[model samples]
Target: GNLNERKFLSTLVKENEVIVDMFAGIGYFSLPIAKHSKPKIIYSIELNLESFKFLTENIKINRLDNIIIPINGDSKTEVIKLSKSGVRAQLSFLVLY
Candidate 1:
């Protein structure tokens, strides 16, 4: 995603809102959103182990561990599990492609 788009998206996030990024590769969108937006929590799901690793590291590096929960697995399956577990988000970013 473009930097401007990320910034714009961040602004759309309301304080204390819960967000879910279905394809949070290396926290591309998650990072900025977690940083600029005061969301209560962000469930970032990534399938690639390598990308997931970077996502976790980025969360720590950005000091957003509390707000961003990095999950390593297929987003489709993970999302189903999350829903069953009663994890709800006010906004969900499902960027395909």
Candidate 2:
């Protein structure tokens, strides 16, 4: 991951904004945003179970469990489920690399 990109992305997050990370990947982007951006909540979705596990652990280690919700499943499917459940995000990050 690029440190500059992560820092830039974090700065874009406004206070009380809701964020959805399509490929959380152990909370790479999610962690920074949660820790510095002051978002109200972040739904961090990861398809890989191993990555998801680390994502949860990272959230705990960062003491951001209250701000980041780690989900283990396909991002698209999980996002649809979240929408149906009335979870709306002000910003959604989908990184492809």
Score every model by TM-score: 0.94, 0.96
Local distance difference test scores for all models: 0.92, 0.93
User: Candidate 2: where is the Cα deviation over 4 Å?
Assistant: none
Residue pairs clashing, model 2: none
Q: TM-score winner among the candidates?
A: 2
Off by over 4 Å in 1: none
Q: What CA RMSD would you report for each candidate?
A: 1.1, 0.8
Q: Give per-residue CA lDDT, model 2, range 1-97, as digits (tens).
A: 6999999999999999999999899999999999879999999999999999999999999999999999999998999999999988999998877
What digit string (tens of lDDT, one per residue) describes model 1 on residues 22-65?
A: 88999999999998989999999999999999999999998999
Best by lDDT: 2
